[model samples]
Every structure is written in structure tokens, then in C-alpha cells.
Target: MANNQRIQLKGRVFITFNIKAVTGLHIGGTESGIEIGGVDKTVIRDPLTNRPYIPGSSLKGKMRSLLEKYKGLRQNQRIGQGYIHSCDNPEEYPNCEVCQVFGVPGERDFATPTRLVVRDVMMTDKSAQDLEVSGRTDLPYTEVKTEVSIDRVTSAANPRQMERVPAGTEFGPAELVYSLYDGDGCDVQKDIEHLRTLVEGLQLLEDDYLGGLGSRGSGKVKLENITVALRVGETYAEEKKLLDKFENLGCLVEKLKELQDQIRQHVGK
Candidate 1:
């Protein structure tokens, strides 16, 4: 009889945060989203309507907020600088780098948002009726690697500065439109501010280079897709699920734009 050694998986999870800036003239800044708070706050804007859409900056900002919670940092202030060199300190340490370089200190330049791709790895081991650690131990296990990529507008080659979309040619499905909410004039104005914040966070990265450290300036980020992957016992079920979810979300976004069009038609905005 053979005793089966339970296969344990251990590996690094390369969770990538693909940050990018906002592009597309029709959709850039003000004209896109709605106002929520004091000013107009933007959420993800519809692509086909020349309206507001959530920028990658918002996603990264939200992630940074979440990370702060995990690290028990102050809520009021922004996180450390990103992976860039703004001051001379980084040149000296060569180790303890600053955060702002990666768009931490102040709102990163609209031109470029410093994206610092960070990763953490963990391993696991199992023993077949054996134990070894400080004294003595041995273990057997299977390693599984997984990663999730949250890609934002990280690409360059600004489309915002491009010539206007041909008049009356029908903006493609990629064009975004703004949806007007049912409310008084002031109410509508408020939502606009909220929508803008989300829009400002968008940063584009190059496409040629996706993750690796060196690829930082190689390519740019585009609004084409957000891919995530996972591995489980030689089967990457999570990755498949994530991709499907991404597709579904994209579809829903399109639907939202259609709804916005209806609003524009009825209200005559």
C-alpha cells in the first residue's frame, strides 16, 4: 500500500497594479463624469459618449487607500511616493526609496504617474510523517503561482490631443457619453465634481512593456483590457473566471452608455 503525500502548493502571487493616465480628448477631464461632493466627481465614464469615466488613477488611489488600512497608516494623507526619483535622497540610499516618484507626494503629473510594481512571495512545505524546522524537519509540497493584473490607463500616445472625431460619423462603441441624473440644477452640478476626481486619477502606461521593472518606460497603458489570472492544482480556474468577469463588466459598461444616450435624448442636454 502506498500512502499518498498531500500535494501542497507554495509560490509567489504577482499581483500587478497596471496604472495609467486618462486619454481621449472627448473623454478627458471635465466633460466626462458627474458631480457627487462639493465638486464634480467622476466615476468610470462610458466610452462611446464623450462623457466621464473612472480613471486608472482612481483605481490606484483606492488600492493605495486599502493598502494603508492594511499597514495602519494615517487616513488623511496620501501614501509614500511611487517608484520614481523626484528628490536627491533616492540617489544616495539606493535602497530605501521614496514613494512620490511613483505619484505619492502630490497628484502625479497628468503627463505621467509613477507606477511601482511591487510583489510579495510566500512558500509552503509538508512532511510525510516527518518534521524539520529549527531542529530537524522535511516536507513535500506542490507550488502554485498566480497573479492578478488591474490595468488602468497606463498608455501614452495621447488620443485626447488628436483631431476631433469626424462629425456625425457616429462615435464608436469605445466612445464614452455622460449621463444626466434626475435632480435640480445644483444637484446635477454636485455630481459632476465627484465624477471629476475619479477622472483625474486616470494615468496611462506604455503597452510594449507590461510589468517587469525595466518595462516602465518601454510601453504605455491602454484602456483596452484588465486581465487577471490564478492557478489551482495545475488548473487555472481563477484566471478564466477573472477574464469572463472582465468581459461581462465591459458589456455592462456599454449598456450604461446606451442608457445615457436615452437620457440625453429625453432631457435634450
Candidate 2:
């Protein structure tokens, strides 16, 4: 249980896919100065393209949150307004699925390399172009919806504008780079199994939602057209495709047991 053994880098797994909005999606953008009733909400956009994109941080954080909630892990780490679970105990950290996959603070003695890295997902070219030319959409690459918050006591109606990506719009070529580390041991079975954790998070997201205002019917999404590949440490330069063009993450989840055997064959050889 000593923290002296060097952590060995086994390899890395790359998962690429498409995320389609099942419902209107709203991931808020920053507004420096806002006058009353002037677009109360806006979607985050790429500075260069001015196109809305799903940030890696948002995607990764949501995945972690969902996994933690599913596992019913104790909420200890306070992030912004909400709390998240993080194992402070080195002995217990290895057993916590959330910690093992998402990782704890690097400063912690028990901290290992975080297994997952979710990349920012951009709006598909076709979706962007279609939204622009449709002329039916309220905004460029997005739509605006007005909702009123009625006061119970005074019955005052406070209406606010919300910007969202229209349902059926696709944002993808999204990628999740998961690391495989053999900590203090040559065996990387645990690292490989962490793949399940990633898939589980994706599946949970499908059942749940992404971005904000999920309860009020925004952020429902689905993953599709997945491609997974592996890069072992020995043959790092030559990456091998494991599951080429799986229909969805659910398919990957279904065959994870067999997939592990495939990974073992590639990495072990």
C-alpha cells in the first residue's frame, strides 16, 4: 500500500462518435453586458467559427456527475454550487469506480492519471448549413424559446428567453481519450475494464440529459456512429481499430466483455 511504485503507462483508448440532440439543447454562453429583455440566454459559441459547440469540460463533468450519482457515491467535493464525490483515502480510492475513472486531485498521494479526456464537440457542417438556410429557425445554428416563471403570491409573470439547438441537430466527431495505466503492477485488466465506466456514463447520459435545464425538456441527446481504437505502449505509433463504426455506445457496452478480450490480445502481444 506504499505510494512508491512508479505508475506504468499501458496505452490509450480513443472513442469517437456523434451526438444528436433528441430535444432542444441549451448550454449557456457568457453575456458581458445585458440590458433588460435582450436575449436572456444564449448558447456558447466558438470564437473563431461563431458556431455553438459542446465543451469538453461540460461533457466530461456531466459524465462524471452521472456516474457518481449512479454509484451513489458520497458527495464530498464542492464544485461551484453542487457537491461531487471524491475519495480522499488512498486505500479506498482504488475501489471507487468514479475516482478510478475520473481521478482525484493530482496533489493527492493516491492520485493517478485521470483515465478520461472528452474533447469539445462541434456542430456538424450539414446541421449548421441546414439551420442557416432553413429560415424557419429563430437564430443562426439555434432557436429561441420564451418561458414564463409565474410568481405564486403575486401571480407576476417573468418571461425569459432561452436559446437552444433544435432537436435532431447533430454535434459531433466528439472524442473521448481514455488512458490505461498499470499502477504498481503489469496487469492492466482494471484499466481496460474502466472502458465500461466510460460507456456506462454515455449510456446514463442517453437515459438522462446533457447541458442545462434538463428537467424542463432541454439537453436530451443520443450518441451514434462510434469508432473505437487502441494505442498500446509498445506499438504506440501504430494505432489499431478495435470497434470500427459501432452503431452506438450501447452496442459497445453490450460487447464489452468480448471487447476486453480483443484489447488483451492486442496489448499483450
Best by TM-score: 2
Deviation in angstroms for 206 in model 2? 0.3
- Candidate 1 lDDT by residue in tens digits, 1-269: 01332222211112222223222112123434433422221122344542223343433443344333433443444236543233333232212112321234443222122223332211112221122223321111111112234446864442211111111111112212222222221122222222222222222122222222212221123343333322232342334222121332344244434433432333332
**Model 1 per-residue lDDT at 68:** 37
The lDDT per prediction is 0.27, 0.85
Put down candidate 2 lDDT per residue, 1-269, tens digits, no spaces.
23677777778888899999999999989976767767888899999998999999999989999999898889998888989998888678877778878878877775777788889999999999998889988777888889999999999999989989899999989999988887563237888877788888989999998998899999999999988888888878774666556898778777878877878877662
Distance (Å) between predicted and true CA of 194, model 1? 31
Q: Model 1 off-target regions past 4 Å? A: 1-52, 74-101, 105-113, 116-269
Q: In model 2, how many backbone clashes occur?
A: 0
Model 1: how far residue 110 lies from native, Å: 21
Q: Relative to the unseen true structure, what is the Cα RMSD of model 1?
A: 25.6
Worst 10 residues of 2 by lDDT: 180-189
